[model samples]
Target chain A: MTTSLKKFRCAALSVVKHDYVARGMAAHPRFELVVVADDPGVPDWIHQRNQKFADEFKIPYVRDVERALKEFHVDVAIVSPEAERHVDLSVRSAKLGLHVVQDKPLTPSRAEADRLLSEIEKSGVRFMMWNRNGLPAVQHAQAEVAAGRIGRPRSVHIDFYFAKDAGPPRGARKTDEQQCGWLEHQIAAHVDGSDGGLGSKPMGELMIEGIYPLAYLRMLTGAEVRRVYAQTASAFHQLYVDHQVDDLAAVSLELDGGLTATIAVGRIGAASHPSGGEIKLHLLGDAGALVIAEGKPDVGVYYRGQPERESRQRRIAAENDFILADNFAQAIDSGGPTMLDARASHAIFCTVEAALESSRTGKAVTVRTF
Target chain B: MTSFFVHTADEAPWRDAARRLHQSRLVAAAGEAHAEVFDGALLTKPPAIRAALEAGRHVLVAAEPCLPRVELDSLQRAAKQRSLLFALFNPDRFLASRQLLRKQIDGPLGSLELLRSHRWENHIAPAPLGLSGSLVGEIEQAAWFYGRPVRSVFAMQPAGLNAVQVQLCFGPGMATIDYCDALQGTTLTGYRSLSLIGSRGSAQVDDHTNTQLAYVGGDGPTGLTVGEGVRHLAAMLDDFASAIAEQRDFSSTVTDALHTLDVVAALQKSLKTHEPVTLEPAEAVR
Candidate 1:
């Protein structure tokens, strides 16, 4: 007997070009990149990058989602938009009977997330979230714990620290319409804007960057967070005077089965390595412990000069982005489980949202199970 | 010469440490041709401890004190009043790696941000001294490194005494001390590691098969030899003899032990309340 490949005609929708995903899908054996949908509201520079990405992938570019859906038969939509826009784009794709692969922070709030999740369930489309850190090491750790190597995990501690400059770039110009976007609107809505500095460009750092670590914790431990107590501060980032979005956040979670996990995240000083950050996850159990240190590039070059010089380390293994795209493709073709799905993504968002609420009320908040 | 009376029992954890002190010529052994100390019978009896205290002999406790709080308190008061040294032997504090760790912390690792210490024993022994007695050494090391008492403690013990995870907040930085005795028999690495992260640099000392201090920043990837067969008990004995001869404060004292007990007490209380326990200066000292 012989098996045939199930072709997935893919379309990528983005405000900024996610060329890695575009390139990854184009390179997959079963995925054919048919369309690139660029939002017209994005800056011209972004559009230029989108055109370049489309040209590199040899795919036709569409200016809007509706046009992409009408012009091509897209089997799946790879949506990488601003956090607030994920729901709208994902819902539209699902409604058009297209499977969805959306970026992190599935939505800014739970209500929008629920709406997107409902649409996907109703449309019966395969939905996967891009969680690149669900790597082999994490899966192996989980397997070991399941195999009784660690013997019933008792607690987990994870620390994630990144450089301030490592954040997404704030473009040259800011418009009034842009200020109404999720990132800016969140600052004005949740925080007092007395200094009038530019709000965090892509919402709070916890929502933007914290999701990956949380997802990794969930993936490793397989423990659902039951409650969260958190403290957040805008300790640094003097650049954002108006936004009270937290640059530093510490969240303590009570997981199911009496396991406790604490996640500490901050945008601080530059790391010595090129990864621009450091991650340490320590999971303790009755039998043994698992310690993982990520963000260390495989090879580093050091030089002695007037001021000195060094290149950030690069990993020798295949990039996580490529693996993530492959996983999405394989899940769609095999009708198997992806590393992360809508429910897991929603749980991450809820945990982050609970952390935000805990910071506000100075108390622990129970995560809403949906 | 300061006379020393070694108290030990059969299978005592610190018997070898006490023997090292006697062998190092740091003190004059004063009982039973040193046969009783070697046989490990004298220390298990309270009468011997009382007789040693009365004779003004500096006593070395070769095991976690199984005495009650009142008796331990009385012993400490008598030792202080008599000006006789009473020290609990914690060998890890005397390791060459510990000295190098101190040097790195005091010299190159600037403005400590966090410290993590992990110690996993091969057996799940009951806390004969107290619930925190087994970890008092780790707590003392943290205090020694930070140069401050633990101001607050939060602990989680999911499996009761089998495992304990403690988060200690000091004046300068924070620390996590995790102890587990689930893994039995000898394994690679022995699962003993200490990590110090600071603003200027970071250092990790893994004291398993080979004791080495690997430090980065200031001077990158500097590996220092933590002398093989370097006797930590001997180093501690030297400190004890010098302190006694000069009539000065020793490296670790009864007061230090009390502080650890207080922190452990607070940690135990916090474990029940599920809230952080704060330690006041007066209470810590008292």
Candidate 2:
């Protein structure tokens, strides 16, 4: 690695059904997708998908993770596997002294997330949880807070709704039909690009998508959540309802220094919004406030014969991936923390865990600290 | 069709509203008025409202009185015993934009799914619009649009901050009100955004669309002029008089205001207890 642009070789670890992260990393000039690899004991569909992605990129597909990491001589591992396998792959790659960039919802288990955090810290490898924190609007909000425009943000509210249908409506399924399976529906959802929470176990909206808004809150306020009170409902998508997971949720967070925050997240069907549903931030500071629409700096396209689904298409400029990649590279070179380090990611996971518990017990739960 | 006496404090926030009500065509302002319109004086002289009701006169409050539940019940009883019309002037309900939004909701917007209202004001110091009053007003506005009783209320007010965030659950649908009044700015301007997401379509009324920025000589753009001059108080007064003549209910009756007050009380209790307050359906007596 040099002060100049140091191009790094990136291993595509388990790009099964999710190649967006791998492709995003390869988009940057500093990273090159070297190989795709996963455990040989995994399912056949996983290997097929990995092979397909590897073939598309003209890279070899290896069945063994360790063998591929050692053979390819990669400097970074872009783990795009399921949520359950995120911490395992990241820890393995970090133990091999490779910087890691993993997917969202870090891991489903708290102990696993903590292990990955500890392992990453021990390895001294830069870890960046691929997030929307690098989006243009997110960056703008960060700049506003850093510039002291809002003056010690007192409250932060984020509305993150993904206007995409997961499956049938909440009550549309017949009483005699079989309940939807998590991995099966997720694999099917890939056809329409709605498999954001792709995994074996069922995940609520807060677990699958809480990181974005939580990262925004952490970035702006620089405070850890102390307590959380949450309300959840399976208001949409029978798939989530069948799994006893929430498609819509609102979480109230009490952070350090009495800074309060709220997050309203939902996977409300596509008909609810014109484009990708409203992603907004409402920040209240001691001296001033800011209301930001994350979809700004975009061009809206509407014409005859436009598809009725997401008819008013908003084409947002694509720079989040590049910025995230550049940030990771910078952190690796300078030994600085990435935009969202492993510690912050663990805190967000704990907060989400607490929110889930609060929703269950119907009482404010103190966030687990470790 | 009745003469109304407007009572306002020296620097009442609703003084302009009182003046507008006094200048309405259907209602006349006189010294010996048969009806009494109470503005910000409700905070200081709440007994005047009860006195007007007790004296067999109709009572109209300019803005949200934020009366306690017990006092509201007393006022309700006094007005009911005398067969007097007790109306609260909810100017937001009568705004042209709000009316248009309602029409859209009933027409093309289809069944409402989500509603979000953001009201931010640049009050250097704690001015007229307090947090509780604004919270009540916003809850009323949300209920008016949702047309459903709030099932639960969860509110959060950051310590040492003049702001309140409330999430109201209406069974399947939900509405959120994020209001902050302690915004610090050189120019005293406000921001309001109301978005209604329904099954079919969406309708939004954002103050940003109506605001104009002038790039004067400074480090940044200086002047932000919001063009909003909807005379809602006059319309409210006209409706009040028409309701009285036709023997019908005003657009926002005392029952609706009481329901709003109930929700506001639940929200306050939630703020204190740090738990969501479940509310039974409001039993309106009109």
Using TM-score as the measure, which candidate wins?
Answer: 2
Q: Per-residue lDDT for A271-333 in model 1, tens only? A: 322454556677777666766666433676455562222335545564566667677777776
Q: Where is model 2 more than 4 Å wrong at Cα?
A: A1-5, A310-317, B1-28, B31-36, B40-46, B54-56, B100-114, B124-131, B146-152, B169-173, B197-202, B222-228, B249-252, B277-286
Candidate 1 chain B weakest lDDT stretch, 10 residues:
B33-42
All candidates: DockQ: 0.15, 0.46
Q: Report the C-alpha displacement of residue A335, candidate 1, in angstroms.
A: 4.4
Task: Estimate TM-scores for all models.
Answer: 0.75, 0.90
Query: Which lDDT tens digits does candidate 1 get at residues B236-263?
Result: 6666667667666542545565676677
TM-score of chain B of 2: 0.84
